[model samples]
Target chain A: MSVLDEVLSANEAYAASFDKGGLALPPARGFAILTCMDARLDPAKYAGLSEGDAHVIRNAGGRASDDAIRSLVISYKLLGTSEWFVIHHTDCGMEFFTDEVITGLLANSLETAALGDDGFYDVGTGPGSDHGQHIDWLTISDQTQAVVDDVVRIKEHPLVPPRIPVHGFLYDVRTGRLIEVPVPSDESAA
Target chain B: MSVLDEVLSANEAYAASFDKGGLALPPARGFAILTCMDARLDPAKYAGLSEGDAHVIRNAGGRASDDAIRSLVISYKLLGTSEWFVIHHTDCGMEFFTDEVITGLLANSLETAALGDDGFYDVGTGPGSDHGQHIDWLTISDQTQAVVDDVVRIKEHPLVPPRIPVHGFLYDVRTGRLIEVPVPSDESAA
Candidate 1:
């Protein structure tokens, strides 16, 4: 079966036993989490969230991209969340390629690139766009530093309230541990 | 205890018994899902995803914003995900406000707004910014149409491979069900 069909079938089983029919519009736990879209890091499992616990905003590197900031703004501004967490993970695919490399690959072809021992290489067919060059891609170099940077970015965004404590952490994909990434004293104090 | 402390405590237990430590960097299921950050929807449980099953990109409304497309591009390009799903849920907070309403709230104060019977009303303190004015917010009008629009946006993006089938669905918040939103015949054919 297609993944869509498989998941929908799973949903049927989930809904058959579904008792969480009255969860409020706002998060019950009064916090939000920003994490990577990595398949391995299940925020609900790692963070022990039941439905209606916290807002989860995820993207490529979980970096505080403008869009992520927008989500965070809405989460706190309209939804009553007070605290926030920026969680990136180890072994992230984002660590494998630079913006230039991915853009170049997209410029060559829209086909999937092969990840060799060295790194990703384009198969090179046709029908690509220059629009890839316009995006930041938000690739990561150092996982620990990326976490700190995202926390700082979210904490410092003008729309984000200074009272909301934004914590940074790195999830270990191998061991399922969340290691706290210390924000610099200066940034943390701010 | 703070919510952070509560979750960290939970993470310790999860890590202690962790055994799935050898999963690869790419998704084992070869699919990606884009959905809302609503606390009521646990994508893992609803979709039957284990750790390393599929890429899950989430935001405020699960709309196909530029950043979402960037993540989708990277998901298929570098990570080998073959299919994608766009899911927006019922009773979404995104349906509670508009760009003008949110921006006006932020302009008044960065404080959280109250959702009354009429709609969201600002608490209004001070120390706000006009930055919210610059954001698209990507709020929802009709939940069903939003899912269709996101799926179409992702499918039509020039960087997206034409062969990847982008499916649309609306998750029922009350029932924990995944209801397929019919993509228009023309878009489905494309």
Candidate 2:
């Protein structure tokens, strides 16, 4: 179903409120590195990347999107990514944002939480809840498997071939230390 | 192969650059959103979402990653996301940054050029050359479908579910419009 335009307009009005607080961030250069634009992420520090070194591609949690893949494909075929790094950090916002809120917002925006799952809104979920303070959060071990699986999947893509190496990493946003996930490396050994 | 320590250090410094930026970008509320942080692709304007809404994920192309999926699982079961959206946009930097820059930068620092499929980097091809400007460049239709496929893959996983709704969209950075890719509206329809 089409997203509610009125809801979007309202969101725009509110999000505009946020622009006043924004850092006026600029785009990265060279190869884009997909990452969380999260202030805590600090992909450069954690991933050991630098500006003008690699394009720091960021989103919510740094999930690879079709465009990311398309960029990756171009990077590999025309550019040079024989491998990739999947970095997901601890206490990520992606962990907390739920469908209920989205549905609720949509319902509230549309003035009737009556829509089913088909109504996917194309608006920002806002800055989301403040999740950076939970120092006691779990290490997110399953997150390791997620990174490994992505590497494997990306490697096996019909367009990418089977040999590409994808490394899985769990970065500690607070500490800036990267812990390698075992699945990809283990599977590569096998 | 492990990521370079210097790279990590540089990234740390870059992240630190934001210390004065002052915007306290909050963690995603429930699910991490993976959308382009492209200045033009405003989530509030397009996705009909807002602050405190959901995890406003961002990246170059909003591609799904293993880490992203892992986080999604946590969001769904632990946090509460029954839905997901993958948004990418036209005129993305992902299309321009070359692989040579990424690989070379990772291999060395910002100065050294990484070799390519043919070898000899300095002359054959330089770093950061994969991406460029397209006159009408931006917004390929398949960009949306790729995200849908990613969502479908995530939903079918034992970690996710088959009933969840997944959406794919391409944002026209110039016109401020969101176009629906030709993915099945409902999985049942497929």
Best by TM-score: 1
> Which tens-of-lDDT digit does each residue in B1-190 have in candidate 1?
9788899999999999999799998899999999999999899999899988999999998889999999999999998999998989999989888899998889989888887786548458787888888889999898888888788888888899889998888889899999889998786536
| Model 2 chain A: lowest-lDDT 10 consecutive positions | A131-140
- Whole-model lDDT per candidate: 0.89, 0.47
Best by lDDT: 1
Off by over 4 Å in 2: A1-190, B1-32, B37-50, B93-141, B185-190
* CAPRI quality band, candidate 1: high
Per-residue lDDT tens digits of candidate 2, residues A23-106?
Answer: 212322333345444444544444544322444444445555444454455444434444466677665654544445443343
i-RMSD values for every candidate model: 0.8, 11.8
TM-score of chain B of 1: 0.96
* lDDT of model number 1: 0.89
Error of 1 at B17 (Å): 0.4
Residue-level lDDT tens digits of model 2 in B165-189: 5566666554455565556657423
Candidate 2 structure lDDT = 0.47
The most accurate candidate by DockQ is 1
